[model samples]
Target: MLAAAALAIAGVAYSSWIFDFIVPTGQDRFRSFLSELEADDVPWHQVYSYGDIVAGVAAVGASLLLFGVRPAGRGATTAVVALGVFGTATVADALAPMGTVPIVHAATSAIAVFSLFVTMGAATWSAFREDNWPIMRTLGATTFALVAIATGWMLGSDRLQGDYLLGLAQRIQVGAMSVWLLVFSVGTWSSTRHARRPKRVPRRR
Candidate 1:
């Protein structure tokens, strides 16, 4: 479980790096789109869009860790929901080269919105358990949920004004949150293994 979480985190970090360095660098068309919006004095939707990308990836990665560590029914549901959102977003992005429209953006936007619900549901469920580190679990879950909600709202409302700084910050947040999940998973796995060890018996005279 811990191992899985660690890998998920690593995946999130790698994805973040790709988005930060690679995606933006070569995206001339996308950048032009943002520039046009700026010239027209429009709010930067590009920034928010990129933010959603990073957040969606991080949410899925964290969901995987939560599933492995807790294995709760709700956790599985959350994982599925997160995956659905990420898949939707990927499809939308792939189709962007073809054209941009309300339909395409709407389809992709749904992913971000749904992710918020997934994170909230999962976190709420996890909070009910009485565990060794209940607080940490709750905190992590809450943090993910809130981030999901914020990103979802930004995407859904078209409030992302395509600011490079905003996009960068969003990516950083996603990557950092993912790292937390990895650490938590490793700790959970280690603790579980330690607790399962057989106890030594005393010999009687």
Candidate 2:
């Protein structure tokens, strides 16, 4: 459980704030996509690529651990699988950088984003079905809703403005997903602890 939590925290460390710190001059977080930072011409492009790889590995490790200890239900199982898919696709995205292979990068990026959406949505549904950890469940539902909204806005922005606001939209979408991941980490920890607790017994009168 501690390992799982650590992996989740490592994944969250790839947040936009960290990216902003490493981002080179002339790269606008609000105007340029995160992938732009991994371009060949960008200074320390390897740092951006390595960050994605680390975050992707962390996501995969956390998902595997959660799968082993996740609540016994199909919804929870589906959520874990979705998270794995997201992580795998993210790794692929890093390998196929937009600067090197635009087509492959786009495809992998789509898969990563879609799977992340599914991860949050499935987690919310599973939490509701399991009826455990009210706080986590509530957070799951709220973050899922926020993520959905952000995704929709991001897609719409891409279609309408043609990249003017796409970067901002993507950042917001990822921010919401990060929030969901944090809640998921807490829920996983709680679930693991619950599973290990000794069952209570009535004392003899």
Top model number, TM-score: 2
Alpha-carbon runs more than 4 Å astray in model 2:
22-24, 132-134, 162-164
Encode model 1's per-residue lDDT on 1-205: one tens digit a residue. 4444543544353343344243343334322332122121324435434443554455455455545555446554554456546535643543452244656555654554455446445534544553432433656566665556545543543455554444434444445445444544454555456667888898899
lDDT of 2 by residue, 21-119 (tens): 655546777767888878888877777788778778788887787766654677777778888888889889989999899999999999998888787
The pairs that clash in candidate 1 are 43-161, 44-160, 44-161, 44-162, 45-160, 45-161, 47-162
Q: Which candidate leads the pack in lDDT?
A: 2
Q: How many residue pairs clash in each candidate?
A: 7, 0
Please give each candidate's TM-score.
0.46, 0.89
CA-lDDT, candidates in order:
0.46, 0.76
The TM-score of candidate 1 is: 0.46
RMSD (Cα, Å) of model 2: 2.2
